[model samples]
Target: MASPHRSDDLHQGDPVEDPPASYEPVNSDDALPYDDYEAEHRPPPTLRLRLAPWDVISTALLLTLLVVLATATNWPWRLYGFLSDVCTGETCGLVPFGVDNYIYPVVWGGIGAAIAAAGVGPFVSLLKGWYMSFWPVLSLTILMVSSVVGDSLTLFSERYWH
Candidate 1:
């Protein structure tokens, strides 16, 4: 014979008490009286733009520095040359690009700014999750691409425009 106090016996055919009629669902998690939510009731917007403002600014500044470097201005080369003298006795290569000029310090300044901005991004709530990883990579890519493009433009201008 089966035991009356068995674990399954207690709930197998037990009657459940109905929820109190006075209780109304106040929160969104509770079942809604309506069939479904519509587009008008969609969730709040997220920050989804591919490039953030800071990334653009940093890339632009770096490209601008490249343009300045291509010029005949001797000050940038002299300054960077003086700074590089302490280390290798040669003018520091500001970027991997072959052109070396006063733009070295300015290029370095823009890179430092990008790094600092990327570092500070995590503290922001929206930037804490996926954005934290995405932003730094994007910033670096933008800077690198801008540098290459600037170099190409410089070469083109010298070859044809002059």
Candidate 2:
């Protein structure tokens, strides 16, 4: 026969068992001695305002490299030139001719701003001791790839379309 009160039964009216005579009860009001000792000895967390000089210097150099690449490849100008060359006369009449003169600068400015914003996160992380050499390298690689892609497109259009 099954017992009336199963071990698993936890009803609220069930009688509570007293603790063993050997068990010592801890008073909630008493604080552990080590708690005070640990609090006194432990160093308080500090906020550091110091900037990492090397990361800043490297980021500056990276920015300089980006500027040099932009100037050398004429990134925005090349893109404008490509668009001007491709969209001419009746073939691309839907878009107003020479509209790129006004639009490209704004478009390229947005792209440049986005790239600069993207670089900021990695630069900050680098300063905060996070390992991030990949960002600068990736930026340079993107510039190189864009330059190559622009040149290739220009060549392809000139050879096949013209």
Candidate 3:
């Protein structure tokens, strides 16, 4: 004979029961406010600025590199000379396409400004509490200053030394 208390026999003939009268179905109207829930669960925005030692050091090194490139190298002048020489031949157009005196400084300055922006802009923004959105104006200012300095130095070297 089979046992009467077996698990299979216990549920074999049981009927489904209805929920109690006190029980109510949950709906959107009964839920907690979304804004409150989100505020409680979401993380707070950060206002602190963090910089690693390496980040500072690297930015300094990059600035130093830009200074060295701007002051030590005559590559801009050399490039200008080469480009100017290329246009001297008859095969070229009758109109001279020689590089202008003002061109290389602007080019070099623009290049230096770009390098500074890419490598050093973040540290500056972090320190000053400014956004990188101002990079263009900063870069333009750098370009103007660097171009003037570069041109002056090149002219001085050409006049006195060479």
Candidate 4:
């Protein structure tokens, strides 16, 4: 049976954290146990996203990349299409926009990837208890795939499908 719990785990330690005198599980119809409350608000069910150190770092990285991409996609260099069009005999870096385009996309992509690997990936692992399954890698892959394919999909939809 799913174990009943006290709502005191929020204090961090043991499964049973109620006051010694009053730590009894609710009498079926009275006050609920601490575990019940915890289960109700658990970060997320197992095999799901879990916040972790990498998540924090990756989130920061993604945010930074977002900033860089936004910055480069504008004026002066217009680096949005830089890396995408690089070495393709097309005007990627300094032609359509400028020199900023050449380096901006790559930098932003790196940041985006890092954010996925570090932030989103780890959080998945954390939620799934990293050891329970392959959450870390799986989560990272999900984000990586999204970032990589998202660009192409956006372009295709806008240019061809739409």
Regions more than 4 Å wrong, model 2: 1-52, 68-118, 123-129, 132-134
* lDDT of predicted model 4: 0.47
Specify the highest-TM-score model's number.
Answer: 2
lDDT of each: 0.46, 0.52, 0.53, 0.47
lDDT tens string, model 3, 61-104?
65566466557998446534433332222443332233234445
Q: Provide TM-scores for the models.
A: 0.28, 0.39, 0.34, 0.23
Worst 10 residues of 4 by lDDT: 153-162
Cα RMSD for predicted model 4: 13.7
Model 3 worst lDDT run, 10 consecutive residues: 87-96
Candidate 2 global CA lDDT score: 0.52
Q: What is the lDDT, from 0 to 100, of the residue 13 in candidate 4?
A: 49
Model 3: CA > 4 A from native: 1-33, 36-44, 79-81, 86-120, 124-162
Off by over 4 Å in 4: 1-83, 86-117, 120-135, 154-162
lDDT of candidate 4 over 1-162, digit per residue (tens): 233444444554435546678556557677666778756655453354454665556555655555465466552143233335333334322333343333445455555664555445544545655532233344345444544553443343333222
**lDDT, candidate 2, 1-162, per-residue tens:** 223433443443444355466956488455335456445534465554445667667767776776776678766575445545553445533333343233334445545644764477575664565644445666555544544554554445444344
Whichever of 2 and 4 has more lDDT, that candidate is: 2
